[model samples]
Structures are given as structure tokens and as C-alpha cells.
Target: MPGYSPPVSMLPSALQTRVDAVEDPVVKQLIKDIVAFYDTETPEANAQDIIKDAEVYRGLGMILPERRRADIAIKQDRLVVIVKDKVIAQGDWEMYDLVACLPVPDRPKPTWNVVIANSTGKDPASSIVLTLTDVAADKFIENAKPVSIRQALLDSLRPYVKEVYDEPVLHVTVHQGSREGVLSFLHRYIIFGYRKPLTILPLSQISNLSYTVVTRLTFNIVVVLTSGEKHEFSMISHDSYEAINQWVTDRYLEDLSLAEERRAKKQRAGPSELEAAAEEASQLPEAEDDSDEEEAEFSEESDSESGGEEEEESDNAGSEAEESDS
Candidate 1:
């Protein structure tokens, strides 16, 4: 939940004030001179577009934030990531387990470049030097944003991933072209495949499994599904078939036992639970009747007090009138 600190705004405050005071529109020559001086002094200085970059930079977000940094589109229900200029809508993961991490690769926190500018001019300032440095972009998530779009973006990012397996209890092998993929075994189910299209398989769907010793150092595992479909995974060098088989069998039995235990608990709580709930509901009317009697008694006492107050006020008024007449 904690995040990085905010970046310094605009140029270093001293430099920014000087830039703002330059009301004259025709200072391109002055900017160039300042830049030339910085060029000799610090080659990284860029003198161009000082006015545009400094002033209007904040307004770019006046439009939708998605329109600017379109990396991850924050819609109401889905998450869209633009990878290599190709827009991909990831439907499988709506909310993340941890906001920063995905199932495989993690999401990068967004950052923006801060323009570091100073007067690089001599003889009453002729030019400026400007360079950029990256810092965590807190603007989108800052409290002062008008549309609360910042909150919406943060809300979409947090605390809802169906996370399992601290590390992938075991890893088989896959054909993902240099990207490491593994067959993750968890207590509940098997994350059968990995990366491209990770699939979760329960005990009901798995038909059978077998291990093959391709060689002394090489091995293979094939899992058959109820639909008669088979998927094969090759193990890394020297990984024994016995270890993989044992792990799979143990995980499967653990999941099966947990499922059966839950079912038995639910069955045991069946009829008596429903009858107890109904009996509790039936007592509500009797409780309401007692409350109603108490309210009636309270109203009668208030009415009697009101009547006494009215008589006392009348007597006081009559005495005051007699005093006025005398």
C-alpha cells in the first residue's frame, strides 16, 4: 500500500521563478545564448522548448489520464495493457493478488521526467540549461486530483488476486521460447500449464498420469484429462520421475481430503441449522410486542407531565394579570 514520494515540481523553484518572470514572448535568442553557455559547460543541457514544456505540462492531464499514458487502461471491469504498441485486454485477472505483481511478470510503477533547468547564462542571463530526470509519478494518485480518477486507478490495482503456491511447489517444463514456465502444484489444484495460457486442473478433470525416463538424465511426464486429451511436460536434467510423481500424488490427495472434509461439515450442519435459523426469526414478533408496550407507557407519562405544565402556566398568568390590575 505504501508508495514512493512525490517528484519536485517544474524546475528547481529558484530557476522556475526566473523563467516565469520573463513575460517577453521574444526571448528565443536569450534562451539560445543561455543554452550555448551551458553547451560549453554541461553538454547534456537542452535549451529548446523551455516555455512549452514548463507551463503547459500540467494541463496534459486535464484530459483523461488514459489518453496520455495509455499503458494500462483502467476501465470499470477489465485491465488492458499496451505491450509493444499492441493493446491486450487481460480478462483472466481483473483484480490482482498484490497490486504490483502479476501472475508471471510484474507491473511497472509509472514515472515521469522532471525538467531540471537553471540559468546557464552570463552577463545578466542569456540562456537556460534543461535536462530530465525520472521520478515516481504521484500526480495521478495524489489527493488533490479533481475527478478522483487517481483513486479509481489505485482501487483497480489492489488486494484481490487468487494467489496460491508460495513459489510453485514444483516445476516441470514448457515450450515458452526462453521464458521460464512451470507446472505449479498447489494444495487445491494444479496450475497445469504456465505463461501463455495457465490452466488450473482439479481432481475431477484429471484422468490419469504417467512418468517416462527418456534417458538417465532426461525425463517426461504426461497428464491425461477426462476428455481423453494428453499434455506432456519434459523435466529438467537429473530430476527424478519418482519425486515428481510423489509430489503430484501427495498434492492431489491433500486437495481431495480437504474437499471431502468441507462436504462432510456442510452435511452435518444441514437440517438442524435451518430449523435454528427459523426458530430465531419466529421470536422477533414477541420482542417487538414488548417494545411497543414500553413505548405506550412512555407516551402516557409524557402526556400527564404536559397537562400539569399547562395548568401551572395558566395559574401563573392569572396571578400576573391580577398584579398588573392592582
Candidate 2:
């Protein structure tokens, strides 16, 4: 029977020997097709290319084994996941809700997974999970420093800078726990959490912010709100504490200057034109009410006088009648 055959020159000597030994025509044809499919060179044919072809096989009602391998890279300001030069996913540091390296069952190496919260949905089911290989995981951790990561997040919120006093951010801290929580920053405000803000405290609302030295090596930060509420955060590094203090001092000076400028401007302008107009309009109603009360009192007095004259006329007529009768 005529059957598909691979070029003997294309295979190694051992493979070519085996193909020659196979007498069954159908079996030989199947082996040829498999070898050709793998060896056929397409554009940048790599593992991803293999998967794409495998998908095509499935579409044609053929069963093919599924395989996946992706590389994650920190490219400048964004984290990118690539599969054979194709970007499968890319996101800024702000897109991530949580990132950690975790071990998989029966796998010797740990896998890195990023949990991304959906902007439109708040439920856990709406979140997306991305897995990265070992090499990519190392690069991610190296670049994901508190300062750099926070800077990326702040860059996205540049529009709110003016309202937030546009003050420089001094320090950033990540909570210490098995499940690492969101990143917190000391900016014009103490903003915490990811995509959705978990806690936001205006600088003005903070009555006192200090750190207690727990030991020579570590410390805990204490934040006192204006309402006498205190929040204590432990496991702060010495360097972070120093940065926080410097930021607090700088913010204090900035606040003082801003207050003085506002006071001077108010004095120079006196009362606003709108304010003066509103005050004059308020007095008009009072004047109108007083005039109405005076008119009512005058009418009451006139009625009393008219009634007295009528009574006096009636008494005079009765006396005249009595005299005439006599």
C-alpha cells in the first residue's frame, strides 16, 4: 500500500532505522505525520507555536496534549507575561491585589501567582490569577520594592496630587503576615490598600503620628486620629521610621505656610462680594416684617377711635329723646 514517508535524510540514523523496520503501512504513515508536524518550521516556532497548532488539531476534531509555559518580566514600569515573544498579560503594580510565591502539589519548585481584583466586580470570583515560572518570579520580587512600587502607584494618581497637597511621599510599608496585606504610603494622606482604597486618612485628621522603639533593631508606628482613636502598626524597620519622621516634619512646615497664605488672602479681600450681597438680602426680610407689624397696630388704633365716636353719638340722641318726653 502507498503510504506517507519522511525523507530519510531528515531523521537521525537510529530513527531512520526504526522507520525502515516498521512494515505496517498505516503505522508508518502515522509516525511520519507526527514527526513532520513537530519538525515543520513556522514563524518563531517554539513551545507556544506547538500549543497553537495543538489547538488547531482540537478544532479539527483531533486530540492533542495541552502544554503551557510563560515568562514574566518587569519591563520598566509594567509587569509583562510573555509566551514566546507574545505578551499574554501586562499590568502596572497597581493592578495587583496580592502577589506571592507558592509551592504546588508534587512540584519541587515554587510558582508565583498574582491575584488581580476586577475593577467592575468586588467578589472573589471576579479576580484573575496569573502564574509565572521561577525565573520570572525572582525578577518580580527584585523590582517590587516598597519605594519603587509605591512610586508607580502614585504616578497613576497624579491628578489628585494638588488636592492632596502635592507633598512628597516619604515612606511605604507592607504589613507582616502569612497573607501579606496591601501596601501603605505616607503621602499628603495615609493611603492604604490596592485597587480599592481600604483606609484613607487626611493629614489634618491625624492628631499624632509616632513610632515606638521596641528594640534596637525594630519599632512599631502609632497613628492617633483627631477623634482620639489610635492605630498601632508593628514590625516597622528603623529606616522606615526615620523616613516617616522626616516626612512628618516637612508636611508640618508646608501646612503652616499654606494656612498663613490663606489668612492673608482673606484679610486682603475683606468679605466676599457674594457674602455682602447675601447679608443685605437677609436684612430686607426683617425690615419688611417690621413695617407689616406697624401697619397692623395703626389699623387697630383707628378702629378703636371710630367705635368711641359712634357710642358718644348714640348717648346724645337718647338724652334728647328723654328731654322731649318731659
Candidate 3:
């Protein structure tokens, strides 16, 4: 072996601070183990081995589910996952739905974060939906506090923030449970991802969404909405990107056209103040008649004054000639 240097056990100083902050022994241990594993070269460990060794824990079976390490990262300065540099699991940390907070050129912080857990152990074809609500920081001190996404950030940060799709995801988890239910859910999951592009216009424009396997099955869907909402849908479904893209594209265009038509209708019906005023004026009696009457009176007075001046001038000229002859 060429100079096998055991991977240096190191972490960013800030991450070390986060590790120290966690109070739960099991969670702290898992974080430490994951960190250590990431520091090493054993990237081929199976999920079973990783779970049994207390290297990682699942959220559902635990008594304190909040403390359990689920498919995603929660309660840290930042969310990150460390996989053996080799195991290409679908739920690997980097394979997450996150968008950069700022412009790409600036390398801004990540505003939204996501993590997927492969629950193949519990059910060969099942998954869990982890709905994270915004809780107050004060509640976190007592235990957990749930709140809306709107309340999480200050008003100033609202404009720049991006969020997950409004729809609740059909998390296609793989496990061993009711075979009928499992198959049904999988069918729905496949159908939904397949039909989505057809219903969505932006998705139709997408060339494809790719999926591959090294350790775990992963579907990487790059969806673009007609409204320009770009998202990466990563799951364990076996559907190809082309199918997903087409379905999403059709659906998005339909929605976009409907929205545009509604906007145009509202614009035509809702009149402005200026337009309303003009319409009201048109409905009233004629004011131009008053203006015409005033002009007629003024013209008659001018004609009478001119006639009086002409008579006075003739009388003055006759009087002057008689006085000169006398």
C-alpha cells in the first residue's frame, strides 16, 4: 500500500462546536462515528452494519424521535452528511435538495435544506414524510416548537428565500410491510413522478432526470416550472428522467396558461380611476351648451358697441365742418 495514512480525524472548528452543543448521547455518538467514518476510507459499509454499530440511527423506532438521526440533518449550525467517499447511497448528504442563498458567483449560503432516508430495512418499499415546521428557539430549550415557514425569517430575508414545493411529497420509502400497501404506494409514486411532467409546463421543457446506482437507488430529477421555480427531486424511484420531464412539462404549461388567462380577464374588467372618471363625465348633461351661450352674448355686445362708435364719429365730423363755414 502506498503510504497508507489513516484518514486524519479532523473537522471544521465550527462543526466541532455544533457537535459539542448536542446533548443526546446517541446523536452525539452517531455524529462522531459518521465524522470518523468520513475521515476513513471504508466507504463500502452496508446500512445494516452502520445501524448495528450505533454509527447511525433511524428516527421512527426511537423513543425520542426528535433526537434520532433521520434521513436529513436537523439542529446544527449547518446541515451536512458524510458518506464513505465510495458508497453511492441515495440518501448521501451531498445528494440533497438545497439551493444557494445568494447568487452563484457570490457563493451565498444555503437557505433551504433537505435530507432523504432510505428506509429499506423497515419496509422494502416504504418511506416516511418528515414535515419540519418552524418552531420558536425558546421552545427548543424546553423541547420542540413548531411554527410556519413564514415566521422563521425576518421580513427582510423573505424576498430572497426559496422553499420546497407546496405539495406534500409522496415519499417512496422501500421496506417490508403490507405487500399490497407497499405495492400500491410504489405504484402511486411511480405514476405521480411519471405524470408530473405532463401536467407541468416547465417540466416538459426539461430534457431528462437521471437515476443510477452504486450503493442505493437514486433518482435525480431536475424540474423547471413555468413560473421558473427550479427544483431537484431526488428519490429512489426507478423512472427515467425523460418520462418525468415530459409529465411535469405538460402539467406546468397547463397551469401557466390558466393563470395567464385569469390575469388578462381581471385586467380587462377592473377599470382605472381615470377611465371611470371619463365614463362618468360622458353620462352627465352637456356643459358645452353653457360655453356656447356665453360666447353668443359677448359677440352681440361687441356689434352694438361698434355701431354706436360709428354714429358718434359721423356727428362729430358734421359739427366741425359747419363751425368752419360760419
lDDT of 3 by residue, 1-326 (tens): 11111121246677878877899989987776675455333444543333332222123111111323333222112122223322212222222222211111112431221112221112212112232333343322222235433233222122322322332223332222212111111111221221102111222233333333323444544434334555443443564445445544454465555457658888988888999999999999965558788889999999999999999999999999999999
Score candidate 1 by TM-score against the native: 0.34
- Compare the candidates by TM-score and give the number of the best one: 1
Better of 1 and 3 by TM-score: 1
Those runs of model 1 whose alpha carbons end farther than 4 Å from true positions after fitting are 1-70, 73-76, 83-87, 90-158, 162-166, 174-181, 189-204, 240-243, 257-326
**CA lDDT of each candidate?**
0.41, 0.47, 0.35
| C-alpha RMSD between model 2 and the true structure | 20.6
Best by lDDT: 2
Error of 2 at 116 (Å): 16
Q: lDDT by residue for model 2 over 118-174, one digit each (tens)?
A: 222223332233343344212333333344322333232333222322222543544
Question: Candidate 2, clashing residue pairs?
Answer: none
Segments of candidate 3 deviating more than 4 angstroms? 1-282
The stretch of ten residues in a row with the least summed lDDT in candidate 1 is 115-124
User: What's model 3's overall lDDT?
Assistant: 0.35
